[model samples]
Target: MSRRSSFVLAALAGALMLSACANTVRGVGRDVGNTVDATGSAVRDVAH
Candidate 1:
Protein backbone atom coordinates (compact mmCIF):
# COMPACT_ATOMS: atom_id res chain seq x y z
CA MET A 1 0.00 0.00 0.00
CA SER A 2 2.77 2.42 0.84
CA ARG A 3 4.65 1.66 -2.34
CA ARG A 4 1.52 2.07 -4.38
CA SER A 5 0.89 5.46 -2.84
CA SER A 6 4.46 6.52 -3.60
CA PHE A 7 4.09 5.42 -7.20
CA VAL A 8 0.87 7.34 -7.60
CA LEU A 9 2.41 10.46 -6.17
CA ALA A 10 5.45 10.13 -8.38
CA ALA A 11 3.31 9.66 -11.47
CA LEU A 12 1.16 12.66 -10.63
CA ALA A 13 4.21 14.82 -10.02
CA GLY A 14 5.79 13.74 -13.31
CA ALA A 15 2.63 14.50 -15.24
CA LEU A 16 2.28 17.90 -13.61
CA MET A 17 5.89 18.77 -14.40
CA LEU A 18 5.56 17.63 -18.01
CA SER A 19 2.33 19.57 -18.46
CA ALA A 20 3.87 22.69 -16.95
CA CYS A 21 6.81 22.48 -19.33
CA ALA A 22 4.56 21.90 -22.31
CA ASN A 23 2.29 24.78 -21.35
CA THR A 24 5.24 27.11 -20.91
CA VAL A 25 6.59 26.27 -24.35
CA ARG A 26 3.19 26.57 -25.95
CA GLY A 27 2.50 29.85 -24.19
CA VAL A 28 5.74 31.30 -25.43
CA GLY A 29 5.03 30.16 -28.97
CA ARG A 30 1.52 31.56 -28.84
CA ASP A 31 2.76 34.83 -27.45
CA VAL A 32 5.14 35.21 -30.37
CA GLY A 33 2.45 34.38 -32.88
CA ASN A 34 -0.10 36.50 -31.10
CA THR A 35 2.22 39.47 -31.22
CA VAL A 36 2.40 39.08 -34.97
CA ASP A 37 -1.39 38.84 -35.16
CA ALA A 38 -1.93 41.73 -32.78
CA THR A 39 -3.37 39.33 -30.24
CA GLY A 40 -6.85 39.38 -31.69
CA SER A 41 -7.55 42.88 -30.53
CA ALA A 42 -10.65 43.15 -32.71
CA VAL A 43 -12.22 40.04 -31.25
CA ARG A 44 -11.50 41.13 -27.70
CA ASP A 45 -13.06 44.53 -28.28
CA VAL A 46 -16.21 42.98 -29.71
CA ALA A 47 -16.51 40.56 -26.79
CA HIS A 48 -16.08 43.30 -24.26
Candidate 2:
Protein backbone atom coordinates (compact mmCIF):
# COMPACT_ATOMS: atom_id res chain seq x y z
CA MET A 1 0.00 0.00 0.00
CA SER A 2 2.66 2.45 1.02
CA ARG A 3 4.90 1.45 -1.88
CA ARG A 4 2.11 1.93 -4.38
CA SER A 5 1.32 5.35 -2.99
CA SER A 6 4.94 6.42 -3.30
CA PHE A 7 5.08 5.27 -6.89
CA VAL A 8 1.94 7.16 -7.74
CA LEU A 9 3.28 10.33 -6.20
CA ALA A 10 6.51 10.01 -8.14
CA ALA A 11 4.69 9.47 -11.39
CA LEU A 12 2.52 12.52 -10.82
CA ALA A 13 5.52 14.69 -10.08
CA GLY A 14 7.31 13.51 -13.20
CA ALA A 15 4.28 14.21 -15.37
CA LEU A 16 3.95 17.72 -13.97
CA MET A 17 7.61 18.48 -14.63
CA LEU A 18 7.46 17.16 -18.18
CA SER A 19 4.31 19.16 -18.92
CA ALA A 20 5.97 22.36 -17.71
CA CYS A 21 9.01 21.72 -19.86
CA ALA A 22 6.88 21.05 -22.94
CA ASN A 23 4.91 24.25 -22.36
CA THR A 24 8.06 26.31 -22.11
CA VAL A 25 9.44 24.80 -25.28
CA ARG A 26 6.17 25.40 -27.15
CA GLY A 27 6.11 29.05 -26.08
CA VAL A 28 9.67 29.62 -27.23
CA GLY A 29 8.96 28.01 -30.57
CA ARG A 30 5.96 30.30 -31.12
CA ASP A 31 8.03 33.38 -30.38
CA VAL A 32 10.77 32.30 -32.75
CA GLY A 33 8.27 31.53 -35.50
CA ASN A 34 6.68 34.94 -35.14
CA THR A 35 10.05 36.65 -35.38
CA VAL A 36 10.94 34.71 -38.48
CA ASP A 37 7.63 35.60 -40.13
CA ALA A 38 8.10 39.29 -39.37
CA THR A 39 11.59 39.25 -40.77
CA GLY A 40 10.41 37.57 -43.93
CA SER A 41 7.72 40.19 -44.43
CA ALA A 42 10.22 42.99 -43.95
CA VAL A 43 12.52 41.48 -46.55
CA ARG A 44 9.71 41.21 -49.07
CA ASP A 45 8.76 44.83 -48.51
CA VAL A 46 12.33 45.94 -49.06
CA ALA A 47 12.60 43.98 -52.34
CA HIS A 48 9.49 45.65 -53.71
| CA lDDT, every model vs. true structure | 0.92, 0.99
Model 2 lDDT tens row, 1-48: 699999999999999999999999999999999999999999999999
TM-score of each: 0.60, 0.74
- Alpha-carbon RMSD, each predicted model: 7.3, 1.9
Candidate 1 off by > 4 Å:
35-48
TM-score result, candidate 2: 0.74
Q: lDDT of candidate 1 vs native?
A: 0.92
Mark the regions of model 2 whose C-alpha exceeds 4 Å error after superposition: none
| Model 2 accuracy (lDDT, Cα) | 0.99
lDDT of 1 by residue, 1-48 (tens): 699999999999999999999999999999899886775887787899
